[model samples]
Target: MSATDEQNLIEVSGLVSHYGDRQVLNNISLDVRENEILVIMGASGSGKSTFLRHLLGLKAPSAGTVKLLGRDITTMTRRELFDLRKQIGVAFQGGALFSSLSLIENIELPLHEHTVLDKDTIQIMARMKLEMMNLLDHEHLMPSELSGGMLKRAGLARAVIMDPRLLFFDEPSSGLDPVTSAELDELIKQLRVALNMTIVIITHEMQSALNIADRVTVLHHGDQIFTGAVDELHASSDARILNMIHRRPSRHGVDSDYIDQLTR
Candidate 1:
């Protein structure tokens, strides 16, 4: 292994996954470098979310190993995985905040559950993260009261409250105006530098990926079709990659045998 390989915070090797009879992921392998933003890009039903679940050890892979901070998450005991998760954070696509809790309560929930820190310390830490995400003034609002951008920021504030070594964000620009999406993209880059955390973002937005990705891995129908810098992606001649990047509809044919079986 090269010195660069030694610096990888998360390493996924030949990962495969399935939901019942349907295979969802092929042999997907990736390494997330320390302090870098790696975007996972794909259209809907392209296995991006399934791949992220494998990374988080949310679903056990059918084969292969996923290593986070040098520990194999696929094989870890529930207790072990829970302990290790303290060093990792995730911000879901829709913020996933509890509607019943205020923003500050939601943000500080992790500290309350995982740490023995005093209430004052937890509150202070939550506020620090909120301030970092430019959300300090809106800490008292409920999830339903906040705008999409503000909710994303609040989710992010919670994700980083633990000061994790690695962060996973799902669709950071999913449903927002162009200017708000651009602002969120900038916030992601800023968080990477400010927190010194390795980030893996799951997004289908080409503009957002290009805006913030240090490198990107593109998935197509469970296959890892491309993984490289944004410029390389743009310069590629592969029709599959180009079609995805250009928002062209896929013209793939269906399997005749599968159709016959379904109709029979």
Candidate 2:
């Protein structure tokens, strides 16, 4: 094996995915190294979320290989996938906490379900994770009682409760104020060093992507458009890449037919 193969926690090669007749990902390939932060960026409908799902083995691709920790998850049995997920963590966009469960309950649910740790030990471990997220004080609060930032933190606490070697976060900055978003970005960066984790984040926020990404993979209409360091992305001359970075609308001229219809 090459040194790159030895270091990568995730390796995708020529991945093609479809939802019925609609293609969602097209010939995408990327590698995520151990302890690095890889941010996947694309606008809505760009297939980044699909890419993230493929990485997590939540959906099997129509073709190509997705290897996580030296095993191809695309071909893993159900039981094997379950075992593999024990070493992976995912924080969804909405926090996805049960409204009926309190912060501590939500955070410790994984342990209670997956392990044989005693109640007190589970609570301690959960509390430690909450403390790391600066949420220890809100341990007993219900999900509905928390603010947007608080909810994200609570969800993050749960995600890292098991200290998974690979962490996948979806839109950590979504709906957050600038201050909260920046704080979350810092925390994400710290997690890489603190836990020695390989993190893959899915986001459309350019600032957040630039702030936390060790490397970035950008998609456009299901195609892998760019994959490299932030500096390289900045230097890219591609019109689509430039439009994304600058948040400009795509250049499509108004046709005479559309204008005539509008006049009618």
Top-TM-score candidate index? 2
Candidate 1 at 10: error in angstroms? 1.1
Tens-digit per-residue lDDT, 1-264, candidate 2: 778787999999999999999999999999999998999999889998888889989898999999998889999999999999999999998899999989999999999989999999999999999999999988999988999998888878899898999999999999999999999999999988999999999999999999999999999899999999999999999999999899888766347788899999
List TM-score per model, in order.
Answer: 0.92, 0.94
Q: After superposition, how far is residue 227 of candidate 2 from its true place, in Å?
A: 0.3
Question: lDDT for model 1, on a 0 to 1 scale?
Answer: 0.92
Clashing pairs in 2: none
Looking at model 1, which ten-residue stretch has the lowest summed lDDT?
247-256
Error of 1 at 72 (Å): 0.7
Each model's lDDT: 0.92, 0.92
Worst lDDT 10-window in candidate 2:
247-256
Question: Taking the tens digit of each residue's C-alpha lDDT, what string does model 1 give over 38-94?
Answer: 999999999999999999999999999999988899889999999999999999988
Give the clashing pairs for model 1: none
Which regions in candidate 1 have their CA more than 4 angstroms from the true location? 1-5, 252-264
